[model samples]
Target chain A: MSGQLTLYTYWRSSAAYRVRIGLALKGLEYASEPVHLVQDGGQQHAAAFAALNPQELVPVLRHGDQVLRQSLAILEYIDETWPKPALLPADAGGRARVRALAQAIACDVHPLNNLRVLQYLERELDVAAPAREAWVRHWIGSGLDAVEKLLAGDPGTGAFCHGDAPGLADCVLVPQLYNARRFGLDLAGWPVIARIDAACAALPAFAAAVPEAQPDGPRS
Target chain B: MSGQLTLYTYWRSSAAYRVRIGLALKGLEYASEPVHLVQDGGQQHAAAFAALNPQELVPVLRHGDQVLRQSLAILEYIDETWPKPALLPADAGGRARVRALAQAIACDVHPLNNLRVLQYLERELDVAAPAREAWVRHWIGSGLDAVEKLLAGDPGTGAFCHGDAPGLADCVLVPQLYNARRFGLDLAGWPVIARIDAACAALPAFAAAVPEAQPDGPRS
Candidate 1:
């Protein structure tokens, strides 16, 4: 937990935002080195960054010689190293529920609308800009709807994704909602997500980690 | 681990295949209550199944009162409860590496091409059958390409996703490859995955869990 944490991140990437919230929750300090996904023909594609992560993706957390790519993976490492504010639950069932919610977003929702996927839709599928936007909204909407069902239906869901205090699922959801709103996707259908996200944003960890508050946030 | 573990699964559902592999690895006995995903307008949509999983997805693992949804969640739960021949690595970094590889499949790849999304493409987007199949192949190809890059590029990858042992990453990769092969997507490009799948299938645990070998498999 004390090994000079360095996060290779993007200000606006939802996945990166998930890791930031996790670090703050665990009271871990890390230097944020931004990797602009779009700037200068994508810095992540550069040889320097590729050396750190062959996937050439951001939210690569480097602790000493160990480099962890994938935001969820980095978050898990942080949780294991610092177990004070546990990201997962105690019981196996509870942990499964929390992880299920996290994957509900991480797996089902975010990938369809990621910058790379969107770019692919345009370049490969020849989808029009407007249709591409619709595609984004479609996947996001269905994904969030499922999440809403998971959160709302389960009595286990408290103020956050699990038991009041923000945990792993909330770490994932808030950033996704940020992207959801940014894309102009209507969230009126997902009340549970709205309430949970509100609770998460109220927390300093989640608030400070918001993409709009980051160093690269739209320049005022 | 001793109780009746019922996996509500479809033979061809890769997500279910993941849990099947996990259960097999843990040497746990379970009932394969087939969910018939494509029959009678997707048996997963039946009122009875919907009550169990509101998400209307296959591969819900039922153990006593607890009904576990999501393949990764069930796999992790099985690992935690059993804790023998651990699916994840011993070290924090190693575990993160394995989980990341798994999520790279569970999160990034399979979700985009799952049953629901394909149904959506056909119904909502008016995509033709061939185009939908092409869509499946496209995502699978791109996703496997990314995964191949991750596994091959990482020096940590030994015989399995981590060291010489097959762990969580193999649990995810093997099933996804089943789906990929079922769809007739080319596997020649993904040597890392191809090699890993071969290793997994060689094991009794992974072998017993193959879709063709399942209770609900064709001719089963």
Candidate 2:
């Protein structure tokens, strides 16, 4: 936990945003190295970055010599290494529930709408902007609808996705909602998710991790 | 671990196959409730299954009162609930590497090529069969390309993805290779993955969990 931490990130990438929230929640300081997913036809495709992660994806965490890819994995590594303000719950069942919620967004929703996938839809598939918009809405809407039901139906849900704390699921959920609103989707359809988003936004960790606050964000 | 275990699964679902492999590795028994993802407009849409998992996704593991959704979460839950013959490595770095490899397939590849996405591409956007095939192959090929690099580049990769034992990454990787082959894509492009796939296929745990062996499978 004490080793030098550095994150290869993009300002608007939700995966990077997830890791930022995680680092903040654990009170871990890390240097930021932005890898623009858009400019210059994607910096992630550069030889240097590709050497760091053959996947050529951002949110790569370099904690000492262990270079990590995948936002969920990096978050888990941070939790296991630090073990304070746990990103996951203590019980196995609770941890499973938290992870399932996280995957609901990370796996089902965000992957469909991320920059690379959108680029493929546009550049290769020749999917028009309107249809592409529909594609994004379709996945996000259905994904959030399920997440709402998951949160609303379960009594375990409190102010956040699991319990009152903003943990792994919250770290993931807030970013997806950010993308949803960016696409001009209404949050009214997912009241539970909207409420959780509100709760998470109030937290300093979540607040500081917003896309707009990053070094390479538009406002900066 | 001793509690009654039930899995709501689809025969051809790579996600369900992952949990099946994990259960097999742990030497745990579970009752399979096959929910055919294709037949009858997908039985996963049924209210009975929806009540269990609003996500309407396969590989929902029910352990006593706790019903879990998401394949990776279920696999992790299985590992935590039963420590013997562990799926993840003992060290934090090793565990992160294994999980990252697993997510490279689960989150990056499978989500894009799953039945629902393919159906959406066809029904919503009216993407032609050839183009849809390209979409599938694009994600799968690139995903496996990354996996192959991760495996071949790392000295840690052995007979399996992480070590000599067939663990979590192996369970996820083999099913993905199966899907790639089903799409008529050649495995020769990814030698490391192909080698690992053959190694995994040699195990009874993996062999018994193949799509063809399931009760709902075609040969059944």
Candidate 3:
């Protein structure tokens, strides 16, 4: 945890945003190497970035010599390496619940509405822009609805997705909500998720990791 | 590990297949509650299953009173609950590597080509059969290609994805390879993955988890 760390990040990428929140929460400092997924046919597709992650994806963490891809895996690695302010709950069952919430977004939701997938729908499938936007909103709505049920229905829920603390699930939820808002989805229906998102945004760790705060963030 | 365990699984679900492999690896027994994803507008959509998992997805693990959703989370829970014959490595870096390899399939590849996504392509977008097949193969090919490099390039990979014994990555790999073959993609191109798949297939733990071996397997 003491060595030099570098993060390959994109300002608006939800997966990258999850990692950013994780690093900040752990109080770990790392140099940022921005990989634009859009500019010039995606800098992630460049030979140099591809060498780092053959998947040609962002949010690649370089911890010393070991390069780790996959946002959830990287989050776990961080949690294991630096156990303080643990990202996951101590018990196995609690950990499973938290992870299920995270995957509810990362696997079940975000993958469907990813930029690359959207691009494929547009380029290969010839989906119109409105249709593509609808696709994004549809998945986000259903995904967040499931998440809201998980969060609201469980007695374990406190101020966050798991316990009172903002943990792994919160890390994923904040970013997904951010993306949802960008698509003009009204989140008033998901009162629990909205509450958690608001709470997370108040914290410096989550606040600093917002898409607009990154070095490569969009200029307003 | 010695209590009533129920798995709501679809016969050919890769995600459920991954969990079945994990359960078998840990030598735990469970009752199979087949939730046919296709029959009668998908049993996963029924009210009972929805109460278990709002995501409306297969591979819901019911251990006593606790209902666990998401395959990767279930795998880790099983590993944590039963330490012997551990699925993840002891070391932090090794665990990260194994998790990354697993996510390379679970997240990067499988979600894209899942039945829900494919059905969306066909029903919602009116994507033709051949184009849909191309989409599936494209993801599987690209995904497995990344896995092959990660395994073959690293010394950490032994007979299995991580070590001499089959672990988490192998659990994910075997099922994905099975799905890929069902799609008629040649495994010959990924010699490393092919070799590991063969090794995993030889194990009774992995062999018992094959889609065809399940009680709910295809009638033919």
Candidate 4:
């Protein structure tokens, strides 16, 4: 809202998708500078993009002079900078719970199955396609199962991951579930998450942030 | 600190060690309930422990009746609940930078090299020792190399990761560097990080929170 906001993102990157949802949810407009992850040995690794984010990862949000990386961190920054329609819960305990739920997927599940890791498994470790697929599903399934348990029993759960409003956890969760489906994992196993996803999908913010809706997406 | 604070942690868990440093930094007293990750087929998976954290992860901090999982989230929780020595910076941009730096290791490098993931790489994929070791080094080296870039180029980085104070990023970085050494990854390559680690190591708080100093650690 304050500066020339630009996001270096990829269509299929779950991390990037998470940030996209955060921006959409905040009703913030930004320029998308798509960095193709798979084309030509990863455009993310290119000197220019790498200069922006030395991690050579996507979802690098540039707000004027400020360069931000890591999806969850960016989400938090967005929430903090534009305090209207807060992404996290009001109470400290609730914020902790939402952050935990988001990290359950972001740190634990998403990192293990990202593009570079999968590439390493294939090219470096010589893991076959089916095995790689299984590896992806294995982590996603277990991680989601844990998340389901976290949601199922907690009295705090409502229409979304926190209360009725979709916040940080929902932003992180929707993209992860999208990635899970992309890798051929079923959502039927986690009814709570499935319902949450349905709720998130009903929102135009979440709808506009999907991979297929991105400028660089295949369908686009 | 009100109510009983009990941490269900594993000795060698990098995640748990992070929370320990956070608690120590805050001068908060807590009971350490060590859950052996390797022994007894990982006590984390035990029914009772699993009930506490359905994620079956360590560093599950129970403050009163509130159970918190995920190290970074727990660290933020500690910061918010007891805002004595802030783990994050006061300014939004600074907080974003610190969180991004912390997450660069937590979400990107650490998860790829953690116990369960390594086990999957070996037991499931049959990746041999040398290859697994290489895999660990690859992630750590690249991650730290990027971290080095993150620290070196930024004027914001001081004696510690952010402005001479050992805050959130330092807590995450030190344990990661420790794990890097455990896997035979040298820290000499990242001078900025190595120097910061040295600075952090000199603190009694960080020293007391080390894995070797824990009740379940080897020395203890």
RMSD of each: 2.0, 1.0, 1.1, 1.0
Ranking by DockQ: 4, 2, 3, 1
Put down candidate 3 lDDT per residue, B1-220, tens digits, no spaces.
Answer: 5558999998799999999999999999899999999998999999989999999998999888888999999999999988889999899999999998998888889999988889888888899999999889988998888888888889999999998988999989899999999999999999999899888888999889988888999766
TM-score of 2: 0.99
**Candidate 2, residues A112-185: lDDT per residue as tens digits?**
99888989999998999998998999999999999999999999899999999889999899989999999999
**Residue lDDT tens for model 2, B1-220:** 4679999888899999999999998888889999988888899999999999999999899999899999999999999999889999999999999999999999999999999999999998889999999999999999998999999999889988998998999989989999999999999988888889999998899988999999888973
lDDT of 3 by residue, A118-145 (tens): 9888998899999899888888998999
Q: Which regions of candidate 3 deviate over 4 angstroms?
A: none
Docking class of 2: high
lDDT of 4 by residue, A49-68 (tens): 99999999998999989999
Candidate 4: which stretches are off by over 4 Å? Answer: none
- Full-model lDDT for every candidate: 0.84, 0.93, 0.91, 0.93
Clashing pairs in 1: none
As for candidate 4, its clashing pairs are none
CA displacement after TM-score superposition, residue B20 of candidate 3 (Å):
0.5
Q: Which candidate, 2 or 4, has the higher lDDT?
A: 4
Q: Candidate 2's error at B165, in angstroms?
A: 0.6
